[model samples]
Target: MPTVDAVVRCPIAPTFRVSQLAGMFDLPPEPHTERRFQVELPGLDQPWQVGLIVGPSGSGKTTVAAAAYGRRLRKRLRWRRDRAVVDGFDRRLSTRAITQALVACGLGSPPAWCRPYHTLSTGEQFRADLARGLVSPGKLLVLDEFTSVVDRPAARLACHAVRRALDRQTFAKRLIAVTCHEDVARWLRPDWVLRMPEGTLTRRCLRRPRLRLEIFRCRHDVWPLFAPHHYLTGKLNHAARCYAGLVDGELATFAATLNHFRPDRLRISRLVTLPKFQGVGLGGAMLDGMGSLLSEAGAESITINAGHPAVIGHCNRSAKWEFRRLYKTGRKPSGMYLQHPHWKTSAGRAVATFRWKFS
Candidate 1:
């Protein structure tokens, strides 16, 4: 949710194994999870040299990367950028500290004035941001959501850059990546692989396996703004809860669920929210809160059917869902579920109905 922030301190013990790191972050240990459709990576390795993690959208891969990176932060660190003005703090320091921190992350020399952050390409920004983390003495490079938005070629190039950097380094520079695209694996050739499934982790050692992608449910208030048609299945539907995004009491998002209460679980007939607040983590918060609320009320899991792949992907990325049952919708379910200019379509299109379970 907080795009890999620069924190005050990373709590990694120098003696902890990679599996411990996985457990700390709630990832599946190695040798058990699949990658690249045929590999299983183990997690008991120590001082990991380099590894690539691949999974489908919303598979909690980034969360795993964050945990590993956090564990590697027990050493001194800094951040660097060649020509971009570094703003924000990893809770490390002011502007001056930022420049030095970049070097500590691995930059040899930083430009006097950093260019504006927006003008840079996503790949450059990613490398530059990572430079800050890399400079840390003995720091493990944790790259989260490594290639979600970049073009395929750029992702490959980025992977090459990282590999080159690690290969040339005289000393060990541990590298770990969390990505949804398996395309980059051939070049990365990670020493280990970790896969995150619905509510659990499967660790693999070396060989990647075919991933079974699934979807989950979340509520965003933007449904009225960008997905109104999807919400109204021929009728006005309310009763969804909403939230204010750090904007005291505005209800920036909302979610509605028609439930079939049972002894073991709660089957959701409907789940919807506004589109404006979809990707901003409000939806995740809503789903998490709702899941907890339902669980406390005697529900073992939450289940739903959704036609939107984006919804499923969001739920999957959340690491909160468990069981997923995909199903078809109307006889002639047109792809034209919701058409909006503001939303990005390259991620994927919505299905007729997505079945989800919460436990």
Candidate 2:
């Protein structure tokens, strides 16, 4: 292992407001000081993928990243705050790759992708930044203030998703994350962690949290909370029976099952998972659980009209569901088209239908 060193010095003025306040409190009016960060990290000789520098605010995490990785780091991770979410990456990458990166990072909504970065929610923007970084990854990728703006659950989910994405890549790269949140340590599963505040470094043997999902019947009122995350924005069918999946008593996934026109059949009219939780397969798990429950209750089959490519691909790959057919729906010239003008294109959009039959 090779050693890396970083030193930051900020000269303090005795006449500054902070120094005056300290003097009033009988504390020493400290002078200029140098803060040092040194670590024995896996260099060109060793096999290592991820590195973490974590501590509270003003703890020199960003300084350490800057000192260690330098200009290459800044160039690779720079986010265009003024650009639309989908346009914030290398133009050389295929559209599929860009969309895939965005989906993997949990900002999979089509509408959100079209909007500018500033318009998105904090969580969405966080995911969009991750997606942009992953689009054209370098030998070293440095991220500052990782998950600082998002909630704890979102932070963990983003960490897990990012790790998964890195694992799937065929090339060799290193990810250095500077964050204050320690809760994501287990989810990130980095090769090493440097706790800046404690001045301690340790190799991580991480254990991921076991996600316990509970599915039960829910009322129509809960749909409003989840409707915004869905790709198709419209009013949910009121007559449908809704089911919500909860992880640790917080709503994670939702689906609406309704009686089909045929006998002994049901259709999933609406399915959605919260944006932060989307990439972790929670939506598919909820769909399977609901299908199992309906099967036990004497339903012959359950079907779904899935337009999202991710959902369609999952259903096709799953043993529990069989792909029925792929077809295109006629263009709607009503309020739906007025609200979502993107669907006005005459290009035939493909929709995949799937069915799960109880034996």
Candidate 3:
């Protein structure tokens, strides 16, 4: 649920066409960087405020989207561009609402009304992140590796959902999806298709992406511990209380407490995955799981201060979260990494913060 203004804008935009993209990718014919191809896009006559960039892995799909959006943010010699602005947002509100906002951004549908991101399937998080990109009005939505984790059926369903959402939009919104999957072309039914092979780009008319349905049930009483623990600990920013994924009624992994504290508008003070579940997905899951709940609580959005790309990816991808550029921390940051400064000695810390949200 970040403010629209906070989303990073690329520094420049390029007038990309199939030929230019193809040349840059070095498809079949090798061309010098300066020898740009006269671009040809038969389908694109009018200006495409929104666009889709399709390519395989290592084909620079993200690079293209990034470049396009950068240009969209820039003021040209003839075109007057307005500075992007966003409304006020807080990262501490309801998680569900945040999930909705993320979905609006193009991440995916929020988890169940109350379930946090930690409890969601990985594919669900992908959709949530897609939704997040879509929330901002008039911004182009770009998704790389658009549907890798999901089975074909689920991917199709997700594609259809997004297509429906975009097709029904009141304002102008663009979508860009990157994938090596040839089948995606058919399922997504995109207005434009840019195919990349061996680092070269080309155009193709293929089938759209497919839609699929999938479901999983909690094997135990897993939903009752999150907010309860937050309330008990008096740390409203606490992200989650459980670590182990449930297999039937037995705990398949270790248990731990995960929490985060936003000391300022720009940084998080405490982010701990605890000891037992240190290397597991607990910390990341908590952030993802709590996203929806935080949004529902009335926060405009959520933010995380993380350096580890893995953790960042968890929030940005596994949980469908976005990030601002890394803010430089002046002092040695404490809280989640080491000991939480808020801990008023051992007495308060001993209360295992391992609570659940399902109840």
Candidate 4:
């Protein structure tokens, strides 16, 4: 149980206003010329994955963290303004490796990867920063002001994504998040917590709150709310049945099912999970639940076509879904194109098809 101590001193000019302000308010004058902080942290004897330094603002959290892990503490990241978000990563990291990090960190949209960091939303930028830093060779990462710039929901989901990513990685890495907001601790569920200013430390295994998503059939009017987040941007199909999944009264997933080739054969035509909620399996749940609905409604066959590797991988591992076929997407033969007569072409793309049934 090594203890770390930090002293913060601000040179005072001792002006007239300073002297008067000290007497009236906590203006830092007269008897109080310096602030001292003492923090006790666990030594390297035990294994730990995550740690949190949390308290109110100006509570000496940063000072304590810097004293303990100065080398890992970084105030800001320099992202290239002229480069895309994926291009801003280290040259040693392959595009696939960088995109994997981004996906694991909850910034999974392919379009966002091509856009510069400045063009991303605040939440997206936060995840991108995490992804870039997480791929580093360093064993330790010190994050200050964690999730401070994003909304509460984004903060919570980002915490979950970070926890999942760290747990899945092979590297024996550790992360220490320094933040003023204490709410994220619930989602983050760090291995230990150090409350600043007073320097209180607690070590315990904390469980993340289990989230339940209630999926239900919904009207297409809700599609607009989720349209922007979909990988393929398009209007909801009028002939398709739409379903919505809600978590704590907030919509988190969307799916549109259609017959496509035959009215009796069902297919999940469009599936989208809000980026923040992607890794949580909501999209797959929406697909399965909607497929079961149609199955119960007398549909003879059910299928799903997926292009994303993650989704395809999930379906491959699931017992409920069986691999069907792979489509070589491109401009089809003129004779074949005449049969479908689709306006847009998916040239040079590969899509995996799967059939859904009771496991």
In model 3, what lDDT does residue 138 have? 51
Worst 10 residues of 3 by lDDT: 76-85
* Candidate 4 regions with alpha-carbon error over 4 angstroms: 19-32, 170-172, 233-236, 325-337, 343-346
lDDT digits (tens) for residues 223-315 of candidate 1: 444333243242323534332232233334444554343454554443443322222234456556666666676765576554444345456
A best-first ranking of the candidates according to their TM-score comes to 4, 2, 3, 1
Candidate 4 lDDT score relative to the true structure: 0.80
Flag clash pairs in model 4.
Answer: 330-347
Query: If candidate 1 were superposed on the true structure by all CA atoms, what would the RMSD be?
Result: 21.4
lDDT of 3 by residue, 12-84 (tens): 2343574687688885533333211112232323444333455556555555444444443311112112311
CA-lDDT, candidates in order: 0.47, 0.77, 0.41, 0.80
Q: C-alpha displacement of 159 in model 2, angstroms?
A: 1.7
Worst 10 residues of 2 by lDDT: 340-349
Q: Alpha-carbon error at 262 in model 1, in Å? A: 90
Better of 1 and 4 by lDDT: 4
Listed in order, each prediction's TM-score against the native is 0.34, 0.82, 0.36, 0.87
Best by TM-score: 4
